[model samples]
Target: MTDSRFSCVLFDLDGTLVDTAPDLTGALNHVLSQHNLAPFSVQKVRNTVGFGARITIERSFAHYGKTLSEDALDLAHAQFLAHYSENICKNSTLFPGVDTVLEDFKSNGIRMSVCTNKTENLSLDLLEQIGVSHYFSSICGSDTVPNKKPHPDHIFSAINRAGGITEESILIGDSMADVESARAAGIPVIVMRYGYTAIPSDELGADLVLDAFSQIPQALRDLSH
Candidate 1:
């Protein structure tokens, strides 16, 4: 638990900071209903969301007992974007204790940034809609770089934008993509236990795994010491 090296905290937007499952599920259900497919349960949607928009849509279609053709995929993708865009924050919210943890970091002079697999525009829109856009000094999304997470480019870009490097940063997320990306970038990672992760949180191989967002500040303190 060595945190002295971490001066900046980089977050993954969708599953890490924001509970975007509701809006995402709504959009998916909209598409499903249009195609005469059954809507999925929230738990099912939650389990399928961390992979990014295309994967989410693909999984949603699969769950509805349908395989999307290229044209159908494109149409569903468009509908999802439009639907989610309009309702991005209507049901989306920061995970519990997220604000307290973020404020604690800011109070301690730690810089913060967002590094997500979502498109830059949608990420910003969602962050702003959720009213936490001002907390981060940098926000890098999939479109911001040539490659997305598991590649480390987006994380590095965020670190750079935050005026730091991997040695002075940590990525807090709930997915294997975050863990692997931070590992590739040579940064420590803290994974939240209660987010939309693909596998068990411990299996992500993060430097630290926390059960709650409220525990983050203490976890960071432990790491720093």
Candidate 2:
């Protein structure tokens, strides 16, 4: 893209920019093992992800045929957090072509930001560890705002932090939450096919759907034209 249709680009961290499933699944399974529950398959976790930590915890318990209580959920959630904090990037990797796409955006002078449901410190830590921290002008995690994805607060907050307004921004994400958030924020969104979404990508209601990150630059270019 020529970086004209949008002044800023907002990204969803987990499934969009990076494949963080390994760390997340590892942490969830670790917590399950502690309670004598069977580990969930990676595919199962992938299908259940894209929400926040609490929903992931609840889904984990439900997957194991266990009921989710507030106390148990809290404990399991903490375990996941603690475990992931130490091993966030153990096997995590950026999706194919992500670096190139990001670099293209940066080279084109498009402002970029991240809005994720992951905790602030964890998101920042992972971004820094993965060598993409310097690309974004602002990174807003769940804790950075009062609401999470599916809510416009994170997207709007990121736009504000990036010094852009809603009319001149776009959200790039891998789930329906991103679509909803962008819709609520009065911006357009593009969804990726390879991200962790609860349902099919076509049903997410994004302005565009891409199968590869490498296609993003061209897609944006087309949009600008």
Candidate 3:
């Protein structure tokens, strides 16, 4: 195995680190059904997975020719969160090779953290439930910092919380927000091609595009140079 490119690696939580769509779809559908909207398929909802819960609920409503008032949206959002918190990991699973890749990074002395748009409490809960919380020294969520991703501070804060230096860190994620944030932070990004990104991964302008978790170490090495 080649030496890794980055001393620290930051990952995105939702579609990048885990397949969270099943439970998310359930949550979205739960809210939609409450509003008398048709339920969406897991596949249909998976397309919007990484965006966040409010947007997901909004999109689900769009499916049924309805729009919520801010008050209704807030109420629906609360209900979605409540239902989601109860079933957060019911059908979620780490992507193929994730555990193995993490173990390899650990053995290689690579510090890791999560920089996700999910709320801090939910992010932590999901990671704990899935038994991967220990792998990340820090897990910074959308609410963990003053601003969220596409904002460099979110990534910088995550790096800081992980005791990682920016010069030796890189982000591994799956969306345009991840790309832009890493760029603004002056770090290279490696995007997961299989993630739930609405656009093609290549268009995210990452330093390296990854087809699988196993490609990460090598991609890091290649990009670091």
* lDDT to native, each model: 0.84, 0.88, 0.88
Residue range 1-225, candidate 2, lDDT tens digits = 464687798999999999999889999889989889888787777788887878988877876678977888888899999999999999999999988878878887889999999988999999999999999999999999998888988888999998877887888999888899989988889999999987899998898999998987777766666
lDDT at 198, model 3: 74
Q: Candidates' TM-scores?
A: 0.93, 0.96, 0.95
TM-score, candidate number 1: 0.93
Q: Supply candidate 3's per-residue lDDT for 133.
A: 93
Candidate order (TM-score): 2, 3, 1
Per-residue C-alpha lDDT of model 1 across residues 1-225, encoded as one tens digit per residue: 234557888999877899998888898899888988888776677778765788888887776677989988999899989998999889888999888878777777788999998888999999888888888988898888898898888788999998876777888998888888999988889998888865888888999999888887777778876
After superposition, candidate 3 runs with Cα above 4 Å error: none
Q: What stretches of model 2 exceed 4 Å from their correct place?
A: 1-3
Cα RMSDs of all predictions?
2.0, 1.3, 1.3
